[model samples]
Every structure is written in C-alpha cells, then in structure tokens.
Target: MSSPRPVWTGLVTVVLAVAPALAACSPEAAPPARADAPVIVPGAPGQSGSGPARSPAEAGPVAADVRFAEAMIPHHRQALEMAGLAAARTGDPLVTAVADRVADGQRPEIAVMESWLRSLGRTPPPAHDHGTGDHGMSGYGMASEEDLTRLRTARGRAFDTLFLTLMIRHHEGAVGMAAQELRRGRDRAMRAMAQDVVSGQQIEIARMRGIQRRLASP
Candidate 1:
C-alpha cells in the first residue's frame, strides 16, 4: 500500500540474482544448453547427425539409378551397332532414317549417362561386359547373340524387317529400364534422363510398330 513498486522491483532483482545460484545448486534445475553445431550419433554413418553434412546428391544414388545408367550404356551400345548396320544392310529408306536418328539421339545420351556415373564416383559398366544376362536384361527384351547373327546375315527387305523387329524389341528394353529408374531412382538428373529414355523410345516403338505393320501388309 505504501509503495509496492519498490518492493516489487527489489523482489525481481533478488530473483534474478538468486536464479543462477539455484540452478547451479541443483543439477536438475534446468537442462543443459543445446549445441550450436549438429550432434552426431554413433554406431553408423548417416544414422541421424553422424559424420559431416552432405549435399543432396552426396548421400549417394540409389542402386536403381546407378544400375539403370550402367545397364543402359551397353544397351545403347548394342542399339548403336544395330543402327550402324542399317545403311549397308537394309534397302528401306525408313529403316535407314530411323537408324540415323536413333544413333544421333542416343550418342549424346550415352555421354551424359557416362558422365553421371563418373560424377557419382562409380565405374560405368564396360561396353562389352553388359551381357544380355546382366542386370536382368534378358527379361527386358535384350537381343540374343543368335538374334544379332540373323540380323547381320539378313539382306534387303529381310534385313529391314529383322532390323525393325529387333529395334522395336531393343527400344522396349530401354523403355523398361527407364521405367524402373522412374520408379526407384532418387537422383533428379538421372530420373530426368530416365524420363527422356521412356518418352523417346516409346515414340520409336510406335514408329517401328507402324513400319512393321506397313511392311507386313500387301
């Protein structure tokens, strides 16, 4: 009643001074201060805050992304070899045109995929090691050795027909790999490449299918 303001101020001052003493006396009075830097949990890398921080891609690509590009390189290699044969082996202008376009489009894509693998510190599969059986490629419409032999030996319209047939199957394999990457890959650039593979080869598939029908008709 007389002057509570001074009393209140004094009381606040006392509490402010005494608070640290109280906290120091009792271990449970207050929790410890948090760290400025990230806390690292032990037992495993990247478990929570373990190890140094990393960029998005530095966490490493999922198996699907790496495998997709690795498998596709030789996949495209086989396609390029087949495309190279069209000019000398086939008489149809349409087949030759498609071969030229496929080689043009895929050469850059192979370079891109190879660069991507190198960026990830991965070794891209060698062109020759990508056997038809590797990475379940047999399931993805890969051409057999016999298939290539028949195509290599085919002449004129026979070559055109076989080339289109094999090209369509090969494109189907690429589309299948791209679709798997779209489903399971985490890397954005690789996923974009996968999407391109899917879209581009689907278009080729349609074109080859149309050509196949035309060639079959009387």
Candidate 2:
C-alpha cells in the first residue's frame, strides 16, 4: 500500500533472514563441543627412527639369523632321530609319548627353517648332518655320535632315563641358541622362531626333569 515496498527489497530481506539458518545447517558447520574425532599427527620429516612397522616376512635376515636357521635345522633333525628310536626301544608310555610329541613338534619346524633358508638363497644343512665338532654347533647341546649310539642300543627303563636326560640337555642347548638369536638376530621371523624354541623347549625341559624324578623315585 505504501506504493508496495520495492520487489528487490523484499527479495534482499528474505535472503538476509535465511542466511544465518543456512550457515547453521551447512556441512562445514563447526562440530559440537563433545566431538571426539581423532587427530593424527604425522612424524617429523627425516626423523631418525625404526621407521614404519613391517611384518617378519618383509624384514631381511642378518648373519645371526642365517646361522640360527642353519644350526637349528640339523639340531632338530637329531632330536627327531632320537624321538624315532623311543617307540621301538622304550617300554615306558611316558617316554613314547614325549618322543612322539618331540617328533611332531620338531618335524614341521625343520621344514620351516629349510624353506626359510631356501627363500634367502642359502643352502640348508643336510638331514644327516649333525653339525658337531668344527661345525661349531656342539655348544648348543647337540648329542654326540657316541651318545646316539648308546641311546640306540639301550633298552627298557635304561633307554627311558637316558633319552629323557639327553633330550633335556638337547632342549637346554636349543634354549641357549634361541637366546643368542634373540640377542643378535635381525630377522623378525627367525627371532620369533627363536622365541618359540626358547619357550617350547623350556617347558619340555621341565617335563623331562619331572619324568626323570619320577623314574628315579620308583
């Protein structure tokens, strides 16, 4: 009626009235005070560190790692050979069971170590190789040929006692080797295998000791 406000005035007023509401509804609106979004702070450039995480398979093996695999392959083979003799030579169920367990556990581990060595373009020791004497693996508690011979010919409870004693010593040697690998090896897979050796063999050592005590008591 007041000559009707200018049409342009009405349009401008409408836009101004909606502007605040539009901003409030926008996707770019500020989050609430309670927002818990995670903030990722990137590392400083050229920082000296271990760098990004990698899996064991991605990591390269060091000399100690290679040595560990090489030594352990033959070590486990000897253990399996001893375990194989228990079934035919010992009448004790305990000896038989432990022998089977040792065989079952070490057989796969030998395969794993051999495959790992091959993957690294290194040759694994032969199955018959005991790595004794100048090979420098005897410190790891490997049984001597004479020891194996005595074990082979022994029978009954005598076989059980000797087997447990030798196997306990063998496991102790494995634990020591694993400790060395843990100390010096760089490959994650080999280190992990070393740890498995430590833990598994330690338990077996304790069990064998208990069997020894039982065998001694009665």
Candidate 3:
C-alpha cells in the first residue's frame, strides 16, 4: 500500500480545494485596484483637507466630473504658461521657486485629467483653450489676455509682485473649482483629484501670501 499522505499535504489539498469557494463568498474578493486611480495626498500637519483615494473602476463619471476635468485642464495650462515666464522674467529667487513648484505639481495633474477624459471617450479641449463658454473665467480666477500680456512683459521685482498677486488669485479660483467638484462630482477618482487640488492650492496660497508680505517689507 502507498504510504499515507502527510498531514500537511492533506491540509494543503483541502485548502486548495476550498480556496475558490472561499474567495467567491468573501467581500474582500473585489477586483484589484486600477493603476490610474486618483490618490489623495494627505495634507500637511494641522490641515484638514485630506481625502480618501478610490479606484476608477468603482464608479462612472457624472456630468460634474466631466465639466471639472474639462475646465481644470485649460486652467492648469494657463498656469503653466505663467510659470514658464518666471525663469526669464523674475530675479527674485522666491518667485522662481514658487513658479517651479506650480509647474511641477500641476503639469502631471493636467495629463491625468486629459487621460481621464480620453478614457471616457471624450476629447480633451485644445491645449490653447482657456476654459471658455460654459466654464468661463468668471469664477475660475483666470487672468485675462491683457493680464497675461502684462505678466509676459514685466521684469525684475515688478514681475515678482505681479506674478504673486495673479497666482494668489489664480490659486483661489482653483480652490473654488475643486470645492465645487467635491460637492457635485460622483466619480471617486475625480473627487480624489479635487480634494488634492483643494489641499495643495490652499497651501500655495498661504505661501504666496507670505511671500507677498516679505516683498512688501523694506
């Protein structure tokens, strides 16, 4: 007669035989998280704006989510344009540093939003579009063409002051937009992105204000 199977081997066989059924009955057997899911970064110490990350597979985008992405894309583009002007225009180390930070943070966010739109079978707006029509600049705090021109032309300390003032206003608008998304958007990924916008830009706004105060002093 063949030797009896070892106890450990028998237990392993039993577990293997039952594993599929166990998984089928388990709540934790949900599909793996999507790679493109938006993750909300925690806010700095003492701040209250952090949010939970969720998989894109969890929910479909609502109209609010679409609108938020469409509008924010161009809004962030304009920000990049402004940030691009910093290296050549400003002598202030603080201004240059903040501009670099803005560009660094928002550039990938724009890509994510655009990719999200494509994933929904929607076309992203033109890169040059500054969120016109239904999502106009009224509440978005976007600088006007004239404002951009002025920013383009100014140099030295003048550029630093104007850049900070405009960026503070711009950040305030983004925060407002993010807040709206949080209230009305249904997609978990979009909501996560919105929360990040709220947390990040608010911090930048405070920093910009501090820089403004420093600029104002003798």
Best by lDDT: 3
User: lDDT by residue for model 3 over 77-183, one digit each (tens)?
Assistant: 88888999999998888888889888877887787777666655567888768543345557678888888899999999899999999999999999999999887
Assess every candidate by TM-score: 0.71, 0.72, 0.72
lDDT of 2 by residue, 70-94 (tens): 8888888889989999989988887
Determine the C-alpha RMSD for candidate 2 after optimal superposition of all C-alphas.
25.7
Better model by lDDT: candidate 2 vs candidate 3: 3
User: How high is the CA lDDT of each candidate model?
Assistant: 0.68, 0.70, 0.72
Candidate 1: tens digits of C-alpha lDDT, residues 6-61: 12233334334433322322222111122112112233444653456434343234
| Weakest lDDT window of 10 consecutive positions for candidate 3 | 23-32
- Indicate the residue-level lDDT of 120 in model 1: 46
Runs in model 3 lying further than 4 Å from the true structure: 1-59, 130-134
RMSD of each: 22.6, 25.7, 17.6
